[model samples]
Target: MSTAIFRFYEELNDFIAPERRRCEFTCVLARAATAKHMIEALGVPHTEVELVLVNGESVGFERVLDDGDRVAVYPKFESLDVSPLLRVREHPLRVTRFVADAHLGGLARLLRMAGFDTLYDNHFADDEIERLAGVERRIVLTRDRELLKRRTITHGCYVRALKPPQQLREVVDRLDLAGSAQPFTRCLTCNAPLRAIAKADVVERLPPAVREQHTRFSTCDVCRRVYWEGSHWLRMRALLETLGC
Candidate 1:
C-alpha cells in the first residue's frame, strides 16, 4: 500500500479526528491520489484549503500524491499574501459573496446592510445551504464545523466569532472585502439592489415627517421597500466605519 504523511495547520486541526489532532498523520492508500482527495480523507474539506505544500514544493489540489510524500496544508490566511504559494487556483478572490446557514440570520442581515449579496433563509437545511453555495458560487458561512467539513462544499468558511456584528467584520476581513464595501446600496431585508426613486413617487408610503423632511429616496427592486436617509443611517454608517468597511 502507498502511504503519505500530512500535517494540517491552525484551525484545520479541528477537523481531524482526536487521534490525529495537531500533528502529522499517516494515510494508507491503494494508489496515487490527488492532494484534494487526501485532504478530504483526513476529514477537512477541500474548500477550507487555500494552499498545499508537498515535500516542500508548492502543489495544486490536482497534483498526484506519492508514497512517503510529506504534505503541509494551510487554512485561509486573512492577513497573509499567499499568491506566491498558490497551488491549484490563482490568488483567492478579493471579494467573496456569502450564503449563511440558517442560524446566522443576524450576520446575514449585517452583510446585507453592508451592501453584500447575502442569501439567507431560516428554513434552509444545512444540505440546502451547501447546494446553493455550489450552484451560486457563494462561500458558505456557517458555525457548524461538521457542515464545513463536507467534501462537496468547494468554498466554505467557519466563522470564529459568535456575535453578529463581529461575524460580519470577520467575514469581510477574511475575504479581503474591505475595498469592495458599498454601504446602503442594498436592501437589508432582502438581497436586492436598491435603486434611486423619486421622492414624489413614494411620498404616500412615507410618514408625514419623512416626506416633509427628506427628498432623496431609494427603493428595493425586489421587495419594493422604500428607503431614505434617516437617523438609523448614521448609526449604520458608524458601525460600518468601525468594521473597516
Candidate 2:
C-alpha cells in the first residue's frame, strides 16, 4: 500500500478526530487517489479547503497522490490575498450572500439583522440547498460537514459554533464582515431589504404606545412588517454592539 503524511491547518482540523488534529498523520492508500477524495475521506470537505500543498509545492484538488507524499491542507484565508497561488475555487465570491440550512435559522436571522442577504428556510431539502447555492452563488452555511461535501456546492462553510450569538461572531470573523454590517437594513424574519415608510401610512397597524412613541419606521416589502426603534430594537442594537458590527 502507498503511504503519505497529511496535515490539516487552522479550522480544518476541527473536522478531524481528536487523535489526528494539529499534527501530521500517516494515511495508507490502497490505490492512487486524487487529493480531493483523500481529503474528504479524512473528513475535511473540499469546499472548506482553500489551498493544498503537496511535498512543499502547491497543487490543486485533482492532483494525484504518490507514495511518501506530504500533503498540507489549509482553510480559507480570509485576511490574506493569495490570488496568485493555486486555489481550489476558481475565484472568491465578489458579494457575500448566504443560504442557511434548516438547523441554522437563528444564525440566519442574525445575519439578516446585520443587513446581509441571507436566505433560510427550515423546510429546505439538501437538493434544494445545493440548487440554490449553484444558481444564486450563495454560500451555504451549515453545521453538517456532509452537506458541504456535496459536489454541486461550490461555495460553502461548515459552521463551527453552536449558539446563535457565537455562530454570528464566528461567521463575521471568518468572512471579515464586520465592516459590512448595516444593521436593521433587512427583514430578520423574511430576509428582505427594509424600506422607510411614512409613519401616517402605517399608523393604523401600530399599537397605541408605538404610534404615539415612535415616528421613524421601516417596513419589509415582502412581509409588510413594520419595524421601529423600541425596547426590542434597543436589545437588538445591544446585541449588535456586543458582536462589534
- Candidate whose lDDT is highest: 2
Which portions of model 1 show Cα errors greater than 4 Å? Answer: 1-3, 17-33, 90-95, 149-152
Backbone clashes in model 1, listed as residue pairs: none
Weakest ten-residue segment in model 1 by summed lDDT: 86-95
Sliding window of 10 residues with minimal summed lDDT for model 2: 28-37
**Candidate 1 lDDT over residue span 88-118, tens digit each:** 5544445578899988999998888888889
For all candidates in order, the CA lDDT equals: 0.84, 0.92
TM-score, prediction 1: 0.85
lDDT of 1 at 129: 88
* Candidate 2 backbone collisions, by pair: none
Per-residue alpha-carbon lDDT of candidate 2 for residues 1-245, written as tens digits (9 for 90 to 100)? 79899999988988999999999999986586999989999999888999999998999888999999999999988778878888887787888999999999999999999999999999999999999999999999999899998988988878988999899999998887889899999999899999999999999999999988999999998989999999988988998898788
